[model samples]
Target: MDRGRMELYNLTLPVGEKHHTLAFLGFLAGDGAPAQAIELQARYISRLITGKVAPPTQKAIKHNLETIKNFSIVRKGKFTYKVPLLKLCDLIACEIGVYPWFWRVFLRDPVLAFMVWYGPIFTAQYRLLGPDSDWDRARAACYRAYDVISANGSQRDKVKVKRDDVTVARRRQVLLFTCGISAMFALGYLGKSRNLHGAIAQWY
Candidate 1:
């Protein structure tokens, strides 16, 4: 989950990609900056997002921020623009795939497993199970499942040995499912007594 969070942060327009200087600057402007500089920054960001603005010029960035601050659109207290928590969460959710690890654990549980195999199979679907759905939600869900799965000593040892492999498989399965590929086939032939092709077709 931490890895996923880092990936999301690393993909953010401002901090991750160097090409979005104007958009980054515009986003900063939206957090309550003055008029003239905000307009300039917005134009710069529009050009940037639209590919009208070329790669950032250090002089331009420095000048724009400086000019904006001088005009009282922004200030240089910590030399950082703090994004609002809700917006930050939305960005993280979109970038890293919301609730990846949590979905893994949810899919692993017998009762919740059906939710993954069949959409909304559970009764209480909308209820929040942990903290708001983000990286923290994923971690908390995983730990909760780990506690249940590892309650037995033997099971706990198995988890210790296969933890890394399991994590990788979970992430892989999620990516595949998101792309519209079902894992039912990979689970192998359930039976040929029934038309296997029909069963697989139903999943799709």
Candidate 2:
């Protein structure tokens, strides 16, 4: 799961493909970062669900290839901006507390996911404001904030994503499911989503 995420960024410098995920685990462990703790736990759960296909020694050697071929992640497509874009947007909606994971919602309630992902005004009301919010004014405020962040940060993003290979493709569905858990930490730093404070209390 950790390896797949660094791959998603298409990380090229410092840690090479062979060692980057280990580097990230080092980042988490050296500092006792809460995320790696959670990841390690999730890995244990994964072992429960699928059981190990290979022993620890062979699994360490084969690594991502050994795990990913078992699941539903993109084994066939070249990576694209749309993949990350949708993933991140869907991620925000899930993290903000008013919605479940987009896929679950799409199955149970596509209308809600559509309103959250495809409709910015509706997205704002549920994401930022509670159900009792004054729709027009609250949504207008959220739109303004989005515009500011979008325009301000637009220049800083430089990944030529449309042409990149799908570096972070997961081999296991459980890994993909748990993989995005780390992204919640990032989103917790934004907006009012403060759920990660417990996980990160020591570091902060």
- Cα RMSD to the true fold for all candidates: 17.8, 19.8
Candidate 1: deviation at residue 164, Å?
87
TM-score of model 1 (CA atoms): 0.21
Query: Which prediction has the highest TM-score against the true structure?
Result: 2
Name the lDDT value of residue 50 in candidate 1: 68
Let me know the TM-score candidate 2 reaches against the reference structure.
Answer: 0.22
Off by over 4 Å in 2: 1-76, 79-82, 98-136, 141-204
Worst 10 residues of 2 by lDDT: 6-15
Could you tell me which residue pairs clash in candidate 2?
A: 68-171
Give the Å shift of residue 90 in candidate 2: 2.0
In candidate 1, what are the lDDT values of residues 92-126, reduced to their tens digit? 33222332233454444432343323431111221
User: Number of clashes in model 2?
Assistant: 1
lDDT of prediction 2: 0.36
Q: What local distance difference test score does each model get?
A: 0.38, 0.36
